[model samples]
Target chain A: MEVNDELVDKIAALAKLEFKGEEKEAIKGDMQRILNFIDKLGEVDTEGVEPLVYMTDETLKLRADEVDQEISQDEALRNAPDKDSDYFKVPKVLKK
Target chain B: MYTSFEQVKREIENGKTVEDITRNYLETIKEKESLNAFLEVFDQDAIEQAKKVDEKLKNNTAGKLAGMVIGLKDNICYKGHAVSASSKILENFESLYSATVVERLLEEDAVIIGRLNCDEFAMGSSNEHSAYGAVKNPHDQNRVPGGSSGGSAAAVAAGLCLATLGSDTGGSIRQPASFCGVVGLKPTYGRVSRWGLIAYGSSLDQIGPLTNTVEDSALILEVIAGSDQKDSTASTKKTDAYSTASKFEGKVKIAVIKETFETDGLDPEIKKNLEERIESLKEQGHTVDYVSLDILDKLVPTYYVLSNAEASSNLSRYDGMRYGYRSERAEDLESTYVKSRTEGFGTEVKRRIMLGTFVLSAGYYDAYYSKAQKVRRIIREKTDEMLRDYDFILSPTTPKTAFEFGANDNDPVSMYLEDIFTVHSNLAGTPAISIPAGFHSNGMPYGLQIMAGSFEEKKLLGFARTLTE
Candidate 1:
């Protein structure tokens, strides 16, 4: 399938990324190649085959809900580029 | 240079302190700083830890890796230390808590010297994608130290550290280990906990060790491998005596994947080296035969589709909001997400995220993402079938030795193909190792990959030890 500019734009939008005119085109070319490469899986006979979501057959072992381990509020906000009073402050989510 | 942890301990037994060893490694790391192996060397912290270990040694309370210094792959978390998967998005971000592996290693008295550079978000075949700079091959300056564990392999190869912990998702550990001419092990998918590893492809990602010797790899795996309460996927099975266990005891059956030899673009010298190694094995009374794997070509495609899909989802958490890099251009919420991501992530990372988004997009999910999962099951079943018939399924760890810096820069597919041989183990969820086979005529070393059945690290390491011998 052709990986066109519109498709790249759509995916980039979904991915929460922006690209310049040339950057989008360059990525478009790359996605085309990658898509064509992955499209080879179309030849596989996956009939009667279950999708291998997890690597092993073992079911997820549920641990008891308890306070096991946690970092302090100070530690949680330690690396934030912008924060205030134990809150990680981002750009205002709702318009002013 | 102290080649092995055993030798490091031997010197300690001869009255040398662990502090001396740490100082010596620090000196070597300083001398070889041009290779760009270590992103940061925890000199003071390592020295403090080493001094404490010396006190432990004096009191006969030392642990398994008392004097062994190791490097983290920048992706593994170490409490209060920077662990940025070599991406600008999370540059200078300190981990709130240590990864389960780091905690285990520190408990065993291993000195974590520093974090090593790698492909941004562990996404490239060559180390060039690292935000800091490309790590040069210690053997040949112009060539790459293969990635995404490039700095880990280079660190061990250059004796910057005795060993390093690297995560393998589609050959991140093994391929770099092969390129750097060191022993790189990718234990069974659940063998080691991924509790604190920065996830790329969650299902395919596994943490393992890159070391100078197979025994060293085995030793490191012993300390770090086991189930963790934090990681539900961590194996519940009992950990094996990987370092002290009996090695391969008899002549073994080996299966050579026939398609590896026939695969186009395999370096001729690498093919010849593989043949000679097989011949040598046969001469030593081991049974070796070719095995059919019609799905050889499908491995890379399935890996890319599934891994990128997972990565796109996994990496979405890195917005301008919480920690790490935030773009100055952001004024509101949506731009905060878009501009920060576009600026923070490198080109290759963005390319992958975009590709991942395309595949998992509404219109094409079945043809790509869902179909790749079914194909993955086929790959796993076929690989397991082969392992049941033979003690080990062997192949070359890479298509060729490490290439020049800009060789495959433009063609991402060519770079993706570098992982063709090594992705098999991750796809199958089996334990595999890259043992340095020998050097090619170009004076670059190649590796032999030996894969064994799932959760059979005891036998896998034994076979690797025998093969290395």
Candidate 2:
């Protein structure tokens, strides 16, 4: 688990983090420690066990998908940190 | 401040109006400024609700929790309130719908006192990673309130609220509750609905109560437990009579795992106290057996891989394009996603998200995520086998008592180790609770964990109630 600066950069890109100079090494150290701990999972004998993902033993009971409540456009936009008329405004997301 | 929820409820019934209760609680929260428990206090809404509850009391329509104040961990949703998981990206985002627990609590006529602080997205062991700030232990301000449900624990511990609701993924509720000297219960997975809870690890995430006593915890559990049509993942099983279950007097068959006490790096006092507690249970006619869970060593890694993978997918919905915070300047959609996420999430969150993506990505899924899941299944099966013979599995909630802020700041591995005693229950989807067993040498609270088979919360809580008494 020798996490290098290059791997740190890649991890940062994937994670969408804005890491500075020394922070990369710090994070690298953290990652190494975590990966080392995670490595211990290899020791367990997991033969023939079904991967338990969702805990509910029963299937998700579904109802006819119906609207319980409706929020007005104005109410929806109230909490937006950045907003415009009837729309949530954001940094220009489309590029040519 | 009275620690029992019954005491608080009695005072409210005697003449203290709901308004008086909320005001006194707000004042108490202000006085205990050292405990950084709350992220946002819903002052207006709480007052309004308190007044309504007061009216209900006068009209002789008070419910079980009439005029009782409750603190909500920031992760639980409350309509018209900023329910950020103590991350900046969601700092301004108000929940559009109340979480199932919130609705149920309101129906019980409980007052929503405020939102307690938490680790970002309920991720960290200590509340230090919260953007708002870390919550200090009410017992000792220097130490952390164990997290990611630190605030809820602190609020209850400090008597700012009668009880609080928190979401537990690995051990968020129980660990913090232990650290803060409260009763924290994690119901069987799907015992409580997760409809409005912002998903952490959807499969493992469960909403439970943090209260001063196991009885209060059960009271809150009764209101919020059972199947919900809103959350498909919620169990369809009938909610049991928790209050009645709490009164069961029996010498419980308790199994204290040998490996759990034998774990390296435990505080000596915690071990002594746990042993003494086990002896006490035995003296009360309960059989205390030493069980060995050899798979205990694999808990930490399996938890991280499974939790991070599920988290990566669960959090993908938070992209600024759909809701919450957006960066001021984004050149394109990719950068918009990048900058918003970069600005919105904290360091720990980014680290987990990246690690999750890495593990689940092409060429790595089977080796990492899938392998972790397989190991998780083994842990579950082994645990089920153990529970067949024992009514409960007991352990120290944490290896050591509450540590000072920054005690493990430099070592992430050390921080992850705090979850060692608590992660197994989540992996097995069992009901677990942490009650105050004793105190550490440092004068901080120590927690004793009791876990039972899935859907055995009544039995587990019954045992916990006896021990706590």
Candidate 3:
């Protein structure tokens, strides 16, 4: 598939990233080249084959619904770039 | 230049205090500062930990890894210590809890010397993508040490630390080990816990060891591998006594993958070394034959598709709200995310995240992501079938030895292709290792890769020890 500038913009938006003017052009070329390379996967006949999501045959192990360990609220919010006393502080989601 | 864990352990037993050993490594780390291997050296904490180990040794109650100085790749979390994954997005981020592997190492009295540098979020083939800057090859300062665990490999190669913990997704650990002329092992996918490791590709990533010798690699694996309640994907299989790997004696059937040697861009010197190694294995009574892996051409593409798809989803949490780098220019939530991510991630990371977004985006998911998954299963089944007949698969760890800086800086495809031989084991979910085979004419070291079926790390490591010996 041809990865054009419009598609690049869409992907960048979905990825929550914005490229500068020249970066967008370079990213477009890179995306196109990489996509073309990965396009060869379509040639392999995967008829009746299941998609392998997990490498191991073992299913995800279940644990009893109990808190084995707990961290204080201060510890939980320690790495937040901007955090109030009990919660993370983000920029306004709703504009006036 | 100490190569074995036993040598260090013997010194400790012979009255060389753990504090002295730790101080020696700290001195080497300072002296070799130009290698740019470590992001942070835990000098004070390491010395204190060594004192405790020395106390234990005095009481004759030392642990398996007592007094061993080790380094952790920046991605592995050490509680209350910085773990950035060598990216600005995680700059100044301190881990709240240690990784299970880190906890295990501490339990065995391993003195963690420091956190080493790596590719940004473990994305690039060369160490150039690190926010801190590139790590130079120890053999020749102008060349790369092969990444994304470049610093971990280079540290062990240069004796900055005896061994280091590095996570492998695709070829992160093994490729760097090959370039740096050290031993690196990527165990079966679920063999090691991924709990406190910063996730890049959830499915493909496994934490392993880079060491100066295969026995040291085996010892580290034995300590770190097991089921973890915190990591559901960690295997529930019983952990083997990997330290006893030398006891196993058998003539194994080994297949040299024909397509790997025939691939374009493979250095002729590496090919010759692999050929000679095969002859030597045959002379030692092991059956060595050439096998054609038709799916070899598709491995790089399949690996990129799946790994990037997972990376996009995994990295979505790095938005400016909770943790990591935040942009001051943002006035709103959406702008915060976009601006923070744009300014925080490096070019290679952005390229991958964009590629991942494109593959997983609407109207193209089936064409790229789903098809790649199906092809992954095909590759896995083919490898499994081959392993059913052969005991192990052998190939060159990388296409070439360490290359000069800016060699493939402009060409991402060439860098991605460098992982072609190593990614297969990750996709197949099998255990594989890279051992220094010989030096190139340029004097840089190359490695021979050995892979075995899933959960066969003991056999693989045992045979690797034989080859290295």
Candidate 4:
């Protein structure tokens, strides 16, 4: 339950959250509380029961693999927070 | 003058304009803005739909809920309307198609007046985690309307809408209904179609109605419940007329799960009210038996593990590339997927996703996910076994009425405890209805839950109506 910096960073990585200094500590406390609740699961005896994966007695049916009308590239990109004419823009990755 | 559903229907039928009814309700919603019950009121669309219904009424073709203004929880889809889930990620996205429930209701000439607010992705217990804002208890503005179906419950409580459709994953529908003093039903898993409902813990999610009376809930459930080719998971059985309860005859025996009542977390007032309701049932000549589901204690943790695991997988479909709210920066596909999900989902959602990913990860799947699934089966088997002798199961819908907003913010486990009374029905895949039994000392309503076997929604609603009466 003693949440320090390293464990916080690891959880954040797993969750894909981008956090700076103070926020990390806050999330760590938040995570600790959640973990505490999860720990309660250990108390139950689940030996013979089958875990329910989905609620339905039915299975999902697959639709025919047909092409639907395609939205124009510009239309799709219209709501993007950052985009170039041809592709979505992002921070440079491979090289400087 | 029109406090009941029958009154509304009768008055509206007698040459009243749908616009007038919707306008009157919108004014009420506006006046009660402090409750934060709605994300957006679609006044123009509602009036327009109502006018159409009025025309139908004039032509002697009025449907079941003609001109009845309904509130849709933000997560349920409505064509050409923003389906935000009260989250920033889907903030600007207008739904491309209506959910099956919405489509069915529209066909019945029910007017959708507004999109009710909810916890983001229907994730939280208190409705506090909504990106838009927390919905306050309609009965007491300072307290939360229990969530993530909080807004829908509050809307019905405040008379802002005739009835609302809310998705129950674990206890979302019934918990809030308990808090707000309305009837909320969580149908057997496949009773209502989920197509176009934004996925939230897919396996546990179901769409059901929240209304002032159990009969109205049944009427709405009949219109919206049934098999739909659009959602394969919808039951293949013909839609049984749920409102047949109006003519239902006979006294039913109900089992009150003793272990659930004895649990440490139940509030004294709630416990007291539950006992009184049981006594009332007995007084009505219905046999009341004390049933014990020795495994009742496992409901919450089992629910969280199974729901979160499925949620982690179902929600993986949302990435920057395919859906709303993509991040501006991304290194590659992996990073884009990670970053968008990380940033898009709220803290509680992230925690569940993380727990799910961890449990289903390489070494731990057997230890966590597999184990949880087994426990789930046991819960269902035990519940099904218990149902054979008892006509229904009864319990408190929530441990207490609405708590102050942020009351459990520092302690998520405390918040999760609120679902204690209602989680078992979801785990067992049974139909359950929560009806207001009485008020707490604080003057807010407390609800009693009645659960029945799969496809026994009408029976459950009938019993609930009898109890509430």
Candidate 5:
């Protein structure tokens, strides 16, 4: 559970966040401490126990595929930080 | 200051208009502005709502919660209102629709006075992590009002509102209730619908009430708990008559978790108060015994791993392009994601997201995420077996009373340990409540936590009502 700067950077990348130099050091320490704490779960024997993904025992309710209500494109893009009249604007993913 | 639901109802019945009551709460909120309990107060909207309620009262067609003023945790959505999870990323994001709980409150004629402050994304135990700022405890300004439902508890304690709706993912509501000397309840996970609650840990999170009394908490729970088509996970099970929870008369079988009392961090005063409460319960003819939970030490760690894992996934939707704060400095799509997230999220949130991503990542998925999930099943099974025999499980809500600001800010692990007694119910998806049991020597209040089997909120509240009485 040794969370080095490289691992912290890798995790941060996956999480879509960046850390400055000093913040990275501090977070590395924090991650290591937390991981060390969580490492105790390894001691427990979970041999045949199925992982409890959901708490309730009820089966997922399926519904017919139909458009019940619709939000206009204007309403949909209301909160978008970068948007045109009918579309959300984003930086180009594919470079020339 | 107004104390109970009955008192407020009596005032309205005695010719006090709903407008008068709403105004009083607004005045109190303004007077206690230094406490930072509220993020925004809906003065005009609340007055309009109250006027309608007054009209209903005159026509003798008022709903059950007519004239009661309530506050909402910032995370719960009210259509067209800014519903930030006390995070910078969502600081300007407005809710597109009302939460099921909010809609239910409006139906019951409950006037939502304001949105209260909480931890950023409900990630931290203390309110200090909030982007708006930490909420000071009404009891002691220097100490924190325990969070992430700190403002909900403080507003109730300070008489700014009769009650507040707070979501409890892991002790968010109850811990603050304990610190503020009010009642906070976290209903069974599926008891309340999560349709418009900004998701944190979807499975662990539940919407509940923070109020001055146990009866008030029960009344709110009764109004909000039920099935919703929007939330498929919301139980199809019939909602209980929770309002009558205080009417039950029986000798309750209570089991005090032996391991909780033995914990090293438990304050001596809290321990004494809990022991006395147990004695009083026994004196009242309720059977009480000690039960061992050998996995007590593992609860906090297990909770953090599982909750953070869910949180990372749930929060991924907050990327810059969709909504919320976007970086103006981004030159590419990847930088837009990274820079927006880096600037938007606070330190604690970033720490948790990274931790979550790490555990759920390849090479460590089974070692951390899967292992924690397996342990979670064991915890749930053990709790279920105990509940089958025992009517309720009793313990201290927190190991200690509220601490001074920044006391555990640098030590996140220690702060996470504060949830030791409360997170078990969230993991098990059972109903649990925190009631003001006693005051600590430091002049702050601590609470007794009572937990029951899943969807047994009526029984749990009945026993809590009896204990509080």
Candidate 6:
């Protein structure tokens, strides 16, 4: 039930987001109120209830593996902010 | 401007070429650009499509939705066009492929005018969270157009488009329709394909139409609802003749949740309006009754817990490697991921992502995420039990009509509560629709919501048409 900078940092890290000092404090406060609000779900008696993952009782319909359409490499890399000839260019991950 | 698809068809039959109609709507969009309802207008593409539809009509081979111009809620994809979901993360990202809804509607000869602005990543109840700007309520410029489908609904209300497609995760479609005084239908979870929609809560989201009339909503549903191999989760059910909605006959039993009207969150004017509609239904020989949902008070909490959890998972795909905005401050892959996400996403999106991550964390997973899932089961089961005897469930779409901008900016929970009545359908996986109920004392319009059993959109639209007429 405790909300603090540590919790916010942990969550932000897990979600692949970053929060600076003042924003972190503000997010902690906002998240505290939100978490407290959602905490009201703790009142329900869910003893034997199964978690409903998918809304339907319909069994998962797996499609047979096959390629119906294929786009060219040019199209695939078209939206990348930075890209090499055929690959998306990201900042260097390792030293040569 | 036409009021419904029926009118559009009639206009075509009377020699009003689809091309002319497209131009008129484009002019309206340009005229009402101040509303910020549309993020972009596909002017040339729409005209070209309209001309093709005219040729098809001349050959008497036109498909359904001929001459009907509609807008997309930014989140739905249209190949070769930009789809931002009104977030900087995906800004200027052109869809490599069209959503199933887009393909189906285009096949049926519908003209897509443009993509409308919405909440960033379809995350907020008000369109203010949009990266572009807030969409003004067509009815009142000073107030918000309810969101995350705010622009979709506003486009329909302002006659900028005949109808629009909106992705409803919680109340995105219905709440905005209520605020804009239009008919919004969120089909059963799998009734429509989610293949092209940028994911929010994968389990909760469904694409539906916001239109000026129930008939138009039904007509659009007819074209877009069907099974798809691309989206295996899309139901294999055969499409229905939803345009026959008005032909629906016989009296139906409807239940109005007692707890909804009792809640302090409800405006007294809205309470009075919905009660009067219930009375009208009774006078029409339908059995209208009040049923208690003891868990009604907890709807928002249950919805937020489950939806945000799914959002956190669904949004992990936005790593800056492949496409979308890449932060210039990145030094390495890790910083690229963190910095791009932190800089690209809005505050609301970050807040939800953080909450989602927390709830699904190791120790808290069982307590928050799993427990909310269990609570969701209760909500769905309870709704199913109610629908067994009643053909439909009814309530005011929102507690109140549209509010002035910045009213709930300081309080996030207050904004989330606007989904109080509308989230029931998303949780229950039941098809639901919001039709114009009447105006409030403040002169802003609201909608009356009607929900039916899963895969029962035919019945839901039928009942909605009867009420709308």
TM-score of chain B of each: 0.99, 0.98, 0.99, 0.97, 0.99, 0.99
On a 0 to 100 scale, what is the lDDT of residue A57 in model 5? 86
Per-prediction TM-score: 0.99, 0.96, 0.99, 0.93, 0.98, 0.98
Over 4 Å off, model 1 = none
Compute the lDDT for candidate 5: 0.91
Evaluated on CA atoms against the true complex, candidate 4 attains a DockQ of 0.44
- Regions more than 4 Å wrong, model 5: none
The residue-by-residue lDDT of candidate 5 on B1-469, one tens digit each, is: 7889899888877889999999988999999999999999999999999999999999999999997899999999998888889999998898888999999999999999989999999987779999999999999999999999999999999999999999999999999999999999999989899999999998799999999888889999999999988899899899988988765597889988899878979999899888988898889898999999899888888999989999999999888998999988877889988999899999999888888999899999999999999999999999999999999999999999999999997889999999999999998999999999888878999999999999899998888887778
Off by over 4 Å in 2: A9-11, A17-20, A67-69, A93-96
**lDDT string, candidate 2, B196-226, tens digits:** 8888888789999999888888888989998
Q: Find the 10 residues in a row with the least total lDDT in model 4 chain B.
A: B321-330
The candidates' DockQ values read 0.86, 0.64, 0.85, 0.44, 0.81, 0.87
Candidate 5, position B276, lDDT:
88
Q: How would you encode candidate 4's per-residue C-alpha lDDT over B362-381 as one tens digit per residue?
A: 66677667877888888888
Model 2's CAPRI class is medium
Return the clash pairs for model 2, or none: none
Docking class of 4: acceptable
Q: Write the per-residue lDDT of candidate 6 for residues B156-272, one digit (tens) a residue.
A: 999998999999999999999999999999999899989999999988999999999888888888889988988878998887889886645798899989998777768999999
**If both were scored by TM-score, which would come out higher, candidate 2 or candidate 4?**
2
Q: Could you give candidate 4's fraction of true interface contacts?
A: 0.52
By DockQ, the best candidate is 6
Best by lDDT: 3
Q: Positional deviation of B65 in candidate 2, in angstroms?
A: 0.9
Candidate 3 per-residue lDDT over residues B78-154, each given as its tens digit: 99899999999999999889999999999999999999999999998889999999999999999999999999999
Candidate 6: give its CA RMSD in angstroms.
Answer: 1.1
Better of 2 and 5 by TM-score: 5
